[model samples]
Target: MGHYSLGVDIGGTFTDIVLLDVQSGDHFSHKELTTPDQPELGVLRGVRILLKRCAVQPQQVVRVVHATTLFTNALIERRGAVTGMITTEGFRDVLEIGRERRYDLYDNFLELIEPLVPRELRLEVAERTEPDGSISRPLDRDQLLAAGQKLKTLGVESIAVAFLHSYRNPEHETAAVQMLQAQLPGIAISSSAAVVAEIREYERFSTTVANAYVKPLADRYISSLEDSLRQEGITAPLFLMQSNGGLVHTKEAKRLPVQLLESGPAAGALVAAQFGRDVSETKILAFDMGGTTAKLSVIEDGEPLVAYTFEAARQKRFRTGSGLPIKISTIELIEIGAGGGSIAHVDHLGLLKVGPRSAGSQPGPACYQKGGEHPTVTDANLCLGYLNPDTFAGGTMKISEAAAKQALDTVAKTLDMDTASCVPGVTDVVNENMAAAARVHIAERGGDAREYSLLVTGGGGPLHGYSVAKKLRLRRMLCPPSAGVASALGLLIAPPKVTRVTTFSNRLSQIKIDALEHAYQELEASAVQTLKESGASSTALVTRRYADLRFVGQGFELVTELPAGPYGDSTPDRIRELFADEYKRVFAITPPVNDVEIVNVRIDVSGAADAKLGKQRDEAATESRVPVRRKAYCPDLAKTVDMPVHQRANLVAGATVAGPAIVEESVSTLIVGSHGSFELLENGIIAVELNTGDRA
Candidate 1:
């Protein structure tokens, strides 16, 4: 009975549910329209449908891994629990004083994201910790009680505790948190040192407060989900996907929901990395375009980039400084942009613009025919004949081309053009938006966009990937099997991982190896203990060591992986050489002769990844094959053309299809332009190679 693993990814517009047979490594998936008001209902509905449809019993499900965007949406919409902040005296304004930098320096009117805890809720207590990690003054118990009382009186559901020099010595913060929990039973409390044991004051406090703000809401959702799963007779141990492309027990997720901010997208990136390695391509630009947003990530050397800090709830999507900063171990991704449900309209300046706003699942896109009259990218695709009316979502849902064109008339008429004439521009605008973002994102990472192959995932990704790749001047694109549910598939293969971070400031020459060794052992033990409590099992457990290093006087540092060591004498020079190589690669300049400083030390412990543990070739290899001919509007040729359409399931390994053509699947469709040829590889991916010297 314990032979299946289930994975669910709750996205903005769709809840993807996949059931994997552990004995056979075969998987089946279904997508359900998300219920925004009560997300758990939609997830439960999809779970039941997939299980019953696949004829799988609930008792067969032994493990469940879930990834969700609920907490991130809550943060962006400012709908989290009422939260308060407790800090040392004279640091009451840390949130407001946020590095004292403006995102848009020249704009006359600039608005920053308001702190999660209001000024009235940010109370300070008497405490002092010197820069040298000495506790000069003891904690004031009376003041702490008074602060807790004020928060309770104000109806604060959660509280964050932060004190000066907490990274070096968390005694005051820990004691205060323990007291608050004992005195104020049932109130959620978070300590800054526990959340992020680093040196930055504002960022640490912000990360802690963000954790507290989302605590109650996440706890409620997780509890509800677990209860619903139990009611459905699926009593598997449920795990949650973290933003770092790792799995953690539900208890850890509930305690620190902020770390799940980019959970779903991070899963997609992980799957992309695995897919790239499978194809022997180490560098990949993973493009995931869902209903509401498109995310891009760069993977090099078969691993996605890992960033130590992230910005959340940005005022502007592409602007770096216009958001709340949180410190954590997370997969690095480009800023999000337009996707399938992004609205299309003419601006005040008489130019068409795609969105930073979306028509979410409730109303969805116009072609869904559920009361949405505004034109969207989905509507444009339908008007262009890229989507079929009867086969949308494997015939579970239907779309109307007439309704799509009627909706497009809103913008077409405004531009004094027919819907056919106005349609290509909508797709072009969206594709260019994604391509521009990709180019800039790759350039900022010191890589060229043309150097990486595009790997497409999500419902919208395959439909738009060809155009985006052309605009980026990329030579190849790849579409995985079961593209629409890739993120959910990713969750099924995610290994349990835990990270431990601490500050250790010292120059390379003066480094105390014995002290560092002791700290590393403690951090490793902590991470191992947390992983043990999660109850995940995998072969070949692994530990990675990293340090944040920088030139002696630099304001920021680059995270560098350090060689595992039983350090005695040669460790300092090894670290120095690694730092110099990385520095020269990034800046194209030689490192200074002076010794550099190590700002932070981190350890990430993970089991051998599940995707590596086992893989079953897709079932498409055994299916009967058939190809049909259909006439669809070719955007590249600016005319309707007759092309052969093949069902992805019917195509066996090594089959080739030349464009212009369409490869249709149950959940997604691939639109290949006339400038490329697609080959169904042995691993079930349609690898597209563009014709050289031809621009689509």
Candidate 2:
């Protein structure tokens, strides 16, 4: 009997499943069109297909890991359960006020994302807790009951309770939850402290509300998936990928679905980081361009950057403070609406514009022949001969070149240009858009993108990576095997981990070693419990501590790692020195007279999973294979050229191909520009090195 593991990643346009043999290191993958109405349908379909193809029995699968963009879709589509919020009396408008900062300071009519909970649904209760965790006013049971009754009358399916200072003392919020659960039986309720026990009330409240809004939907979906899997005789443990590139059990995922908002993207980053580690590339730019969005992240020192906060459903895609802020640990990445299914059209200014809107799986692109009329990035790729019309989706899903031409023709007529001319423009626009976003993202992180190697993943990533990399002046790019479904691979590689944080506001000089130790002990205990519940063994657990520190009066804090120890009087000084070092590294200067304050304490507990899989070494090709030549539109040359098409499977280690070529794989295609060269590495990765001096 052979043991195996299954990983599934559900995206907007496709659900990808990968089955890995634990002992043999064999892997098979399948991609199915996503059913937006019920994403699990696509997941199950892909899983069954992959299993049957691999001849693997359900019982042989020992672990099942999954990642999805369902919660994020729901948030963006405003399709979550009808939700209401209950907050401390005077803070009912915190979600709306949101620091009163405009994302676009110059735009007179700048619009912000509408609050998920409207003012009418944002009720207030009479309760108060001071910043020091002292009760200033007790919870008024009558007011809470009244609020519950009103919420019930309003037909709210879920409720969120966010009392001010609940991060320091959750007792008031806990009492309110108990009362609401009793008064409003069968309704889903979430408390801010339980969701994010950190200082910022607005961010905490928003995160809790977001969680509650999606809780019912996530619970139902997860239950349905489990039941379906059981019926299929796959009774393996199910784990969900989190936004922080960690794995959490399905039960915990349902309780905190907000943590899974960026789960799929995070998985891509994790895989990119792992690939970087394997190749000894410490600095990498992970580029994931799927059917609906493009995500970019920075990986340094074998780890993806992690941020303590994220914005969801931003009105301005590139602008901060334009969305609902959620206080949760997440892989720091920049996402833009640039993907294969992104619709293209001529804007009011008579200029071609690529999307922020996607056709999704239902309509897909015009080439899918599913009655979509609009031209899309995929259609442009097809028209430009970048995609295979006959062998698309491994020949299972046929693409219609006629449909693609017609769609592009319609858009070209609007621009008064030929379809061939318009095709390159579309591709160039989307690539430049992604490159520009990546540039801004890297620059903001205090790094130059040109200094990093690009690791491309996702269905469309390889197809567009070279062009984007060229725009960023990047000289090297890598497309690993199974790049199209890298997120699913990432699920298997991720560890079972939990991160817990609590608000601890104290000046460094005023901090007591005993109090600090106690706080960490509580956090570690909670993490241990979570890891146990997630099926990780206690013996394999590892714990690390960090504190969010800043000079007094600073608006934000930098995370500083702490040493594990039995606290002595010298510990405070040691921590202060660590903070100073980090501060200097980030800002290039540390204030000599400024007092440092610790605002939040975080503890991360992780347990390594059995991620060992067999590797198959690639042998050198026996002979130099002749490339199939095809007439393809070359954007750099502004004309059609005979481009070499090489089947990736036929290439072996040390196989090198040069210039204006297409490396075709069943799942994706890698386009080498006029001045680029590609070599197959021993590990089955295609390493494309570009001449930076070339125009294309």
Candidate 3:
């Protein structure tokens, strides 16, 4: 039987599935509305659709690599299983106490982020380990067994074990877990040492607890998916897309679902990187706007920037320390509530406001006629002539113009404006919100967004990308072919990877070089074994080393990469020089000589790049045919005008379309405005060049 590989990504609104022929790079894709109540339902449904479209039998499928936001949604909605935490006697309140810093100092009512685990549920045990891995007091077996018995009686869904300094010596935590397993046979257990293995007791414990909270759900879903696929006669080893822009075994992902929290958006960054390589630009801003949210990520040198820790499901939107912090490496990206499903309405002050709320896929936008009465971003686009009502979702779902008009009229009346004026106003407001978010995000990262090109993807991205880019003063925008499904396509190209971190505090000047080298070697060996267990071949193994370093007096540190070679074998002078350089890069200056400490060491293992990794560019290929032109309004120039309507399949590589045109594809449409033009690139990407002479 011919073999096929599938890449599936489940987003808030839609579940995307891409099936590819193993030898050939040819692929087929399907998009189905996600069943939020039962996300796996949509996944299975999308897979079936993909198989039928590709004319492949289930047994012919070789492997399936998937990414999903299910775990993230559970955390956001606070729907995950109830979880309990076990910590050293005095540290039971770490999750509750948090950093104890107020985000807004001036506010009369300072709202503290609620702890993931409540105080009553946090159980304590008598166990202690020093930073140097010396046992201060041995574990009290009776105390641990009683805690386990109490937890079992409490009906806790899962348990997190985070004793003092577990990162340095996990013996106590591991022993406690072993005892708990004997008492509580089916309870899900997680330890800070295995989850993050970093300093900062509060942060590490919180991260592990969060991981434990989602463990059962993630494991069940992944197991169900595997069983369903196996029953269908597909036997290929399953891989999963991770937040770090790489893939890993499904089994490994189930144990540490926190790493997969940002999986969907990370895929978009990968696809953006591929696009950047095509144009010879290493710096890019990946803009992925889908039905429920928009994601923005920075890419430099063909790699998506990574952050060691991230917060999820913030009670306060757009603020740090307001969510559950996960201590796992992930592609650093910003997500906002501006997307196709974002509702537009006039607030109490009569000012038109776009959303931090969405209609999502169930009710969707009013244009979808799915019982939604609110005027969403999609409705605004439809009313403003930016979308083809009848051709939405490739005509599988016909849109209702009447519903869109009615919804827009309600907002218009509330704002004391006509529908015609309200339509553009809504779209403009939403576009500005997105641009503002991008600006704040870029500024915080010490980068000017104007210097980078915007690579737009997702269903609504291409429609609003130009205006957003204009707001940021970016000259060019690129709407890759199948931009709406780019995240899923990115999954097809991701390589298998895994990361492990260990906290070992020491003065680089005083520590024995040989001892440090030995520790690093041990970490590397563990990483290699994990990769192999996850199906990576010996020849495919690749490793990268990093250190979390800072001045001895500093409370926090930045992650810096070590030069390729044997880790920790360098001289003290070399180590000091490297640290100083990185410190200067981050803080613009280095501290005077005192002492330097390396708090953590991280190792990442990535498999060899897939043979079918890159996209094919048939530069010699031409557009098949051109369709007739049509009249479409151009809001950029603030006028209704005639515009060319071209089928995406018929657009050749050299095909050029001036401003005021709609390039229609099965997944989404690209709107070239009055002052803009589009030309197909060497690949299938559509280069949208604005009047500034820069193509996006």
TM-scores, one per candidate: 0.97, 0.97, 0.96
lDDT of 3 by residue, 142-249 (tens): 999888888879899899999998888999988988888888988999878888888898789888988999999998999988888787777888888889988888
* Regions of candidate 1 where Cα sits further than 4 Å from its true position: 537-539, 611-626, 692-696
State the lDDT at 413 in candidate 3.
Answer: 90
Question: Model 2, 1-696: lDDT tens per residue?
Answer: 548888899988888787877776656677789998988888888888778766778888888899999999899889999999999898899988888898998999998788888899999989889989999999998999999999999999999999999999999988999989988888999999999999887788889999999999989998999898998889998999999989999989988898999999999999899888888898999999999999999999999999999899888887889988988999999998998899999999999999988998889999999988888999988878888888786555999889988988988999999887788999899999999989898888778888999999998999999889888999899998888888888888889989999999999888888999999999999989988998899999989899999888888999988998667899988998999998888888888655789999998899996575344222123355777888887655667899999877778689677788898876778888887889988867889998888434
The local lDDT score (0 to 100) that residue 465 gets in candidate 2 is 92
User: CA shift at 221, candidate 1, in angstroms?
Assistant: 0.7
**What is candidate 1's lDDT per residue for 94-174, written digit by digit as tens?**
999998999998878899889999999999999998767899999999999999999999999999999998999999999
Clashing pairs in 1: none
| Residue runs of model 3 more than 4 Å from their true location after superposition | 567-569, 611-624, 693-696
Count of backbone collisions in candidate 2: 0
Worst 10 residues of 3 by lDDT: 613-622
